[model samples]
Target: MATSPTTTGPRAPAGPGKDDRLTPRGKLALSLLCAAQFIIALDFSILNVALPVLGDDLHMRQADLQWAVTAFALPSGGFLLLFGRIADLFGRRRLFIAGLVLFTLASVLATAAWGLAPFLIARALQGLGAAAVVPTGMSLLTTTFPEGPQRNKALAVSGTILSLGYTVGMLLGGVMTDQLGWRSTMALLAAAGGIVAIAAPALLTDSRPTERPKLDIPGAVTVTGGLLCVIYALSTAADQGFGGLDVIATLVVGVLLLAAFVVVELRVAQPLVSLQMLRRPTVAFGNLGGLTTFSMMSSVIFLLTLYLQDVLGLSAFETSLVFAVQGAVLVGTGTAASRIVAALGARTTLVAGLTVQSVFTAALLFLSGDDDVWLAVTALALASVGHMSAVVSYGINATSGLPDNAQGLATGLVTSAQQLGITIGIPVLSAFAASRVGSLERAGEDARTALLGGTRTGVGVDAALVLVSVLLIGFGLRRADRR
Candidate 1:
C-alpha cells in the first residue's frame, strides 16, 4: 500500500485548541479556492439563458442547441476521476492553475466564435478544463484546512458560493444576454477565469503524494468513456426519448464499459479509484446524500423554470428573478451551516438538511398554472436552507476520517457525485415530465394545462425520491455511527 504523508504541504499554524482559526494568508487562499469553485458553477448555468440568442446568431439548428450543454457536461463529468488521481500524483496547485488557464482560453474562444462547431469545441475544452479543476480544487481545500470545524467552515463558504454561482448565473445570463448580447456571457466567464488563474499560483500551495504510483490507464479509460457515454445518452434520451436506437446503444455501451472498469480496478496493481476507500460508511452514504440533494434540486429547478416561462407566461428575466430569491436564502444558510454540523454531527445534519429540502419541494405540488409565482418563490427560498446545509455537511461527512494522501481521490468522488447529479437530474425528470405532458395532451388537456400537469408530476416524484434518500442515508449512516 502507498503511504500518505502526515501533513499536506505547509498549512496555517495551529496548536491544540487553535486549529479552527485561519490566519490572514489562509483566508486569502480559501477565498481564491472558493472563487475557482464559483466560476465552475457559474459556467454551468450562465450559458443556458443565452443559448437561444446564440443559436440565432450562429444559425445553429434546433437539434444542435443541446450540444452546447452536453459538450461541457461530458468531459467535465467524465474526466474528473482521472484528473483527480493525476493531481494526487503530480501536484494539486499546478493542475489547478493549468485548468483555470485552459478554461479562460476556452471562454475566449467561445466569445470569438462565429459558428456552432467552434463554439462547441470551446465548450468541450472548457469542460476538460473544469474536469482538472474541480477535484484538485476540492482536495486543496480539504488538505489546507484540517478536518473538523475549520474544514466545515471552509466547506460551508465554498458550498454556499457554489450554489450561489449557479443561481446568479441564471439571473446574469438573462440580463447580460438582453442588454449586451449573448457573447457577453462567455466574456464574463473569460474574465473571471483569467483573474482566478492569475491569482492561484500566488495563493495556493502545491502538494502530491510521497510515492508516485503508476497511472491506471485501463481503469481511467474505461471509467472516463463509460461516464461520457452515460451522460451523453442520458442527455439525448431527455430530448429524443429512451426508445431511440442511439440512446439505447449508448446506454448499453456505457454500462458495459463501467462493468469493465470495475473488473479492471479489482485486478489492477494501483487502481484509479480505490474500492476500499468507497466502503467507508461516511464516504458511501455521504456521496449518496450529495448526489440526491444536487439531482433533486436541479430537477426541481428545471421544472420550475418551465413552469415560470412556458406555463405562467413569464419572460426569461422574470423567471430568473424568481430563482434569485433562492440564491439569497442560500447565502444566509451557508453562513450558519458550520454551526449546525458542529452541534448535530455530519450524519444528523445530512439527514435533517435533506428532509427539510424534501418537505419544501413537496409544497411545490400546490402550484397551479394560473397565478402561483409567490408559491414557487417561497418554496425555492425555503428549500435553499436545506440545500445549503446538505451541500456543506455532505462534503464534511464524505471527507471526514480519510487520510491526507487520499484527499484527492476522496474529493474526486465527492465532486464527481456533484457533476453526475447535475448531468443526470434534468434528464430523468424531464423525460418523466415529457411523458406526463404527452399523456395529458392525449387526454384532451390544453398545452398550458398539460405542461402544468407534467411539472407537478415531476416535482411530486422528486419530493418522494428525496424522502427515500432520507431513509436510506439516515439509517445507513446510523448503522455506521453505531459501529
Candidate 2:
C-alpha cells in the first residue's frame, strides 16, 4: 500500500464551500453524529441512578461502588488526547465506527454481567469507546460542515440535542431503573449504540491524511497516565483524607508524569499535542472556560443530588425532574447560541455566557432547606442555559481559523478539558462537602442541617470557580486574541 496517509478532515462530497446549505446526505450524516451525542448523555445519567442497584445485586461494598462511575470516567478522560490524535492519524470515521461497535458490545456485556469484575470491565470498555467517539465526532463535524452558517447550524443542533439528551436520560434513567430494573438502562445504551453504529457506515465518509506522523508513544503514555493518576488522586482524597499516603503519592506521580509529558512534547517531532497550539489564546482560554463551566455543572449536580434526595426527602424521580429543568433550558440556549455568536462574536458570547453562569451560581449560595428547593431549581436552570451558551461559544471560538490538520487536536483539547473537568469536579467538590460535614456534625447540628451546610459549601465553591473563569474571559476574550 502507498504511504500517502492523510489527516482526517471532511471527505464530504461537497467539500468546503461558499454556500452553507446542506445536501440531503449531509443532514442524514449530521443526524447520526448527533445521535451518538444523545447516547453519551443518556448513558451518563442512567449509570449513576443504577449504581446502587448494581452494587446490591453484585454484593459489592459501598466503597467499591464508586468504581462503577470511576472505571468509566478514568479511561474516558485519560485517553481522549491519545485517541483524538489517533483519529487524525488513522481516520476519524474508522475510529468512530470501531468505537461505536465496542460501545454497543460493552453495553451488552454490562447488562448481562453475572459478577462485579465483568461489569467493571464492560464499563472500562465503554469508556474507552467513548474516548474514541466524542473527539472524533466533533472533529468530523468541524470538517464536514463548512464554517459560517452551515457549521454554526450543525453545532447549534448538536448542542441542543446534547442538552436535551441529558434531560431525557435523567428522566428515562429513573423510570427505567424503577420500573423495568437497572438492567434496562444498559439495554437502552446498547440499543442506541447499535442504531448509531449501523447508520454510521452509510452516512459518514472518512478522509485520509497525506502524511501519517509517527505516533508519539512517550507523549501519549505520559499524558494519559498523568491524567489517570490525577483523577485517581482526587477520587482517593474524596474518600480518604487528602493528607493520606495514597492521595499524596498519586498526586506526586501525576504531577511528575505530566511534567514529563511536557518535556516529551517539546522533544518529539510528531507530538501528541502541538506545543504551538497550546499557546493560542483561543485554545488556552477556550479550554479554561470549558473546564470551568463543565466542572461547576458537574459539581452542582453532585451537590444537588445529595441535597434533593437526602435533605429535601425527594424521590430519585423527583430529583431528576428538578434537574430536567436545567437540561431543558440548556437545549433552548444551545439552539440560540449560534445567533448570539453571530451578533457578538464568539469571544463576546463566551464572556457573556461566563457572566450569566456566575450570576446564577452565586444566587444558589442563598438556598437553604428552609427556603423552597425551587430556589436551587431556578438557579440551576439559568446556570444551565448560561453553561450551554459558554459551551457552544467556546467551541466555535476555539476551533475557528484553525488549519484543517489541527482541528482534531483542537477538538480533543476541548473534549478532554470537558471530561477532566467533570471527573475532577465531582470528587473535589464532594470532598469540600464532606469536609464541612464533620465540622457541622460536631457543632451539634441535626443530620439534615449538617448535610445542608456541606452541600451549600460545595455550591459556594462552584460559584467561586465560575467567577474565576469570568476573570479569564475578561483578559482573553478579545478580537486580537482569536487568532
Using lDDT as the measure, which candidate wins? 1
lDDT of 2: 0.83
Q: How do the residues 70-116 of candidate 2 rate in per-residue lDDT, one tens digit apiece?
A: 88888889999999999888888999999999999999999999999
Residue 430 in model 1: lDDT: 92
Clashing pairs in 1: none
Can you tell me which runs of candidate 2 are displaced by over 4 Å? 1-20, 479-483
Global lDDT of each candidate: 0.90, 0.83
Error of 2 at 156 (Å): 2.5
**Which 10 residues in a row give candidate 2 its minimum summed lDDT?**
1-10
How many residue pairs clash in each candidate at the backbone level? 0, 6
Residue lDDT tens for model 1, 85-106:
9999998999999999999999
Please report how far candidate 1 places residue 310 from its true position, in Å: 1.8
**Model 1 ranges with Cα > 4 A deviation:** 1-8, 15-19
Top TM-score model: 1
